[model samples]
Target: MGEEPREHRLATPEGDICWFEWGEPSDRPSLLLLHATGFHARLWDQVVAALPSGFHVVAPDQRGHGRSFRPASLADWTANAAALLPLVDRFAGRPLIGGGHSMGAYVLTRLAAERPGAFRSLLLIDPVIMDPALYAGGDAAPVPDPADHPIARRRDRWADAEEMRARFADRLPYSRWQPQVLADYCEHGLLPAPSGEGYELACPPALEASMYQNALRTDPYAWLGNLDAPVTLVRAPAGPREGGLDFSQSPTWTGLGAQIGAVRDELWSANSHFIPMEDPARVAALLAGIAANQG
Candidate 1:
């Protein structure tokens, strides 16, 4: 892996979108990465490093959290779109590979569906596709996420070690994690609150839950099927919710796997929801192979 610069933030109308551009910027069809809810672009560093040399990779921190905080609206989605067209225009209008994890994948699918011909393909990781109403059994909009459910929001302090680590571990699917990854998640993922005794999560529980509610109203299959470019879905075999929410399935992974077969190609990651953090090498290899065939 070549030494790469740390991620920088892009000034957008909605908020400053945090992103890191690595490899040959002149490379055609840049790789645009969209991370899952509650996480940032830094999570993709290990995976991006393993990508083929000369391939440009741009990973953006979405609205509401990370470096891109506040004043965010649905228009923020447009900013997500802005991150792409200009980048791709610089590279011979090469097919831009739009890759995302969890809610990142959910929003990317919306982008592909919203504009069919603009992007080259879709790469989703353990995407959240079910409507919040399904989980709530017909609750109105702004549904609370299961993990961040009011009860789970009560932390013992501004930085409670036992509480935070336990909750973080509870969110993940696997019983074990790479030591560094686990530590990094715990350190960067939490922030001190006014309480001064323990820490609260950096991402807003209500806002995060609301984003899922907003996405569930839209259908990925309906929206993504309209994409002009082929689609490559990288789904998780299983993991922590990352956003502290359970992914209520519609047809479930079993059915979506069959449905996603309609796409050009689909690879399964069979780990946890935090695929980029957990299995970036595998993802890098899969994406590299697919991009090669498409090229």
Candidate 2:
């Protein structure tokens, strides 16, 4: 493990976007890690721990997650990337390797395209980009009512991190996670309750649900093929094409790898959509390789 990350926050109109930093800048390629929706940046602690020293690393809480601002609604998914533009610009000094998971990957794709030189390369881990067909013709899935969404119904309160860990230790997707990664998730995933008792989810259930409901609204295909940087897509096993948020399987389009000009597709059948959490060491190794090649 490396030195503990130093927490920092950047003020935004909505509120503040919290981020974590590690190591000092040097000639080496800088790394930025983006986490999946509903998950905070600290969830990447295990992966960062395995990374080599002497390279600057950053992990942000995005807008509506972790210690960041809690907006009234998160229906506009593109807003996250927009909010992160400044941070990306500031960290692009050295060659930057952007590593993102799921929604974070989607956000980085947008940033990499919008700000050409902001990223030297991208490592997209199980990004939630759906089949291009869904975005080509018309509107994607209709935004569901926050009140009626399944994720909205998730439990919001926990006695403590230990309780949260104990409750989810045997759960499906969580059970597959590396134990320490799961521990990191629980440890930093909670915030003090407004009532001054116990804790509530750092990402409110309704907001997280709203983000999911509008997931397909922000399509990355517009600039996906136009990206100048090399991209590596790590995908989980293909599951039934049927609908629903099946985290056990990947949500990435099967043909996505072939769609990009400079890309590599790696299908890891043994893991689920949470590849980083399932295997942080391998993810770290892959990032280190990309940094080495780009540096």
Candidate 3:
């Protein structure tokens, strides 16, 4: 049986980051898992439970999300990378296995590039790093106004977690998630509302909107070639047909793996961008395989 995750909080220059740990503390190889925007570290609970023993796992609730501190400026995606550096440095002497999904994946790539020896291998699942051509000539992608975006304008207050779950149970993305996964999301995704009447999303709607609006500002392509560790990219097919729509279609640039000298570029034709949440057990097996190969 997998151990229950131990919660922790680490103070950094950017803010206090909340995290959870699983497995033996004395394990030889350690894994660092980063959650996507608006998600928390506990979201990886099922995936951690399914993994093999002998590897320690660390999953952090990134800034502006979950229980972590929200920074004043929510526009810069690179700030997320900067905030995580101190934690990466803490594991300098040990071999680290790093992996992330979506925005988290992009942050891991940036960290690996900035500190080459931080991780022995990387698993990037449907990262949002786009093609440089799209932002060439100093042209930036247009961001939707926060006031106009539905995510920003979402209802935050719910009578309880159960009420929140019931409200979203039949919704598009939540409907696709497994029962336990959806329950975990509800349990950890909400905080007591300020008015003490109900629960509110840990990551406020406007902050999530800001993350999406400024996502394209940082170009991961600029630093991907600098990483020395082996990389494995597990990508899903473009959205709408599989389950639901995502921010990008085939977000990983064509031939990006080759350009970055990645060891493996596996494509799951049947899965959607939310592969981590959709099939966490598969992700666990992949991580176990990667760790075993390194051993």
lDDT, candidates in the order shown: 0.58, 0.87, 0.81
Lowest summed lDDT across 10 adjacent residues in model 2 is found at: 135-144
Highest-scoring model, lDDT: 2
lDDT of 2: 0.87
Query: What lDDT would candidate 1 get against the real structure?
Result: 0.58
TM-score of 2: 0.96
How do the predictions measure up, each by TM-score? Answer: 0.72, 0.96, 0.92
Q: Which portions of model 3 miss their true places by more than 4 Å?
A: 137-145, 239-249
lDDT of 2 by residue, 79-151 (tens): 8888888788776566788999999999989889888877789999999898987766334456668878888
**How far out, in Å, is residue 92 in model 1?**
8.7
RMSD score of candidate 1 (Å): 5.3
Candidate 1 least-lDDT 10 residues: 243-252
Q: Which model scores highest in TM-score?
A: 2
Flag the better candidate by lDDT, 1 or 2: 2
